[model samples]
Target chain A: MSNEETAGSKPSEKVIELRLPSRLGYERVAMDAASSLARRMGFEGDRIAALKTAVSEAVTNAIEHGNQHNETMKVVVLLTVRDDELIVSVTDQGSKSIDEAYVSRVPNISEAMQKDDKGGWGIWLIRELMDEVEFTKAPGGGNQVRMVIHLER
Target chain B: MTTTRQHIIEISFPSEFGYEVIAREAIATFARCVGFDRDRIDDLKTAVSEACINAIEHGNKKVHGLTIDIVGVYDGNMLQIDIADQGIQQYQVAGAPATIEEKIAGKAPARGMGLLLMTQLADEAHFLPDTNGTRGNRFRLIWRERVETLEPEH
Candidate 1:
């Protein structure tokens, strides 16, 4: 089966889309969906929470980093069910690139999580939670992020 | 014969504070059972709260009459918690997933970092959808034993 196809009948595949606003209000729904889906897929309790948090942080970064917290620009998240795995892709219509140097330098989470260090950490948090991650340019002038977390064996 | 230890909590709310409260309570209960230290409890609470907040704010989109289902399992040294939410159409967003590493390393823009943090905090992580011949959505959280500590002096 292809990457997008879920492990069921052709029509069984499901997808969800949401608009991530700058305010925290819009992000909640996606987070909830992520948590529930994680749990149902047989992820242990702690891991489920982590995946949800990861989705939140990524969407936030898409808003903060990609969109620069701009209200007009919409932050988009696509949650798809593939065979044996859940694929969640978030995209933002912004020109800014992710700060790879800042995220990679602080390999240790304790260091990246330092209270005083507020410059960049959201992206770091997202990387720590999910299993696979990818970054690509969107069709228009924007960025796309696809993160994959597998269902338990 | 041995009996399994199971704890369950069901929460439903339309505001951010509700998510925070339930997350804190769930973490506290889990920490106490696992003998987690104060610092460890704090970490668990923060991580759980972040997850809950994301659910309420992003997944459910602050919709009323919606509920988040949470379950905790204590398997000897291991502690597992499950949080589930029904799918709501209003909260769904659209776009392709981005590459997290490239963005973080300056090779590209940031993406998919939240999964990294949760995985870092917890020993394991996974993602699933409810499509059980039904129309709603469900997710989960899985982790190993929490860091334990001695009780503080009065």
Candidate 2:
């Protein structure tokens, strides 16, 4: 599942790229790919599950919101493994600026859940699970959500 | 009650995680047709997906032979989506931690995030019991278009 741009790239820094159709069925594909990469990096049990959930939430947001399930649109995920951290970035074809809508800080889960609100948890979960979460405009266009997880070794 | 400004699209599919894409696509398309901006459409799609996922996983408990029914109603500049599952169980909805101290000490619960996402993405999101007293859980998501002006008047 890992994509190596350079066959002999440094072991500590390798990048994996995945392109998937902006469809819900493909979400599982992204999750599996992320999980496999995380597992290969020595993440176990709860950490692996957290990575999978975080990737799933990011891909789900890209497909359901950013790409709007348009067949022509694609969700691009890049996983970069560093010596001490893993960085995952999800890019979608939508041009809307998420800066205004995105809440920079962790939401008050206790208060939010009590209101029985139906939405706004995906980003929160991503932020909570990953060591660092960021939103930025993609290179060619569209939006990108980048998340980082610190390695335990 | 029907009005000239109302356009309704209803779909029924097995209660499965895979079918959530269909519901998301349907709502996105409908929102686009109603002249909503790209940002607004994306918000609606996110909200719809959260609701649909909740229905499939929590409402139906991923049970076989059950179905999730979704209805999208576009009334003028506002769009409302209703996702229903044929399950009688109710979920406990609690509020997020009120202070930074509480959040730092609290662990995020997996089960409740979907509902929280739905409310944040949509303008309004709430649950309603089956009007006819049927055995099901219904979630409603609403999004309204922001009014825009062409130019400042002299």
Question: Could you tell me the C-alpha RMSD of candidate 2 in Å?
Answer: 19.4
Chain A TM-score, prediction 2: 0.84
Total clashes for model 1: 78
Give the DockQ (C-alpha) for candidate 2.
Answer: 0.02
Candidate 1 docking quality: incorrect, acceptable, medium or high: incorrect
Which regions of candidate 2 are displaced past 4 Å? A1-11, A99-101, A105-117, B1-154
Tens digit per residue, CA lDDT, model 2, A1-153: 222233344554555455655656556655665665566667867987998898989988887778776745777777676767778899999875665556575577688778867677898899889899888889878889999988797
Q: How high is the lDDT of residue B26 in model 2?
A: 48
| DockQ per model, Cα | 0.01, 0.02
- Against the native chain B, each candidate's TM-score is 0.65, 0.82
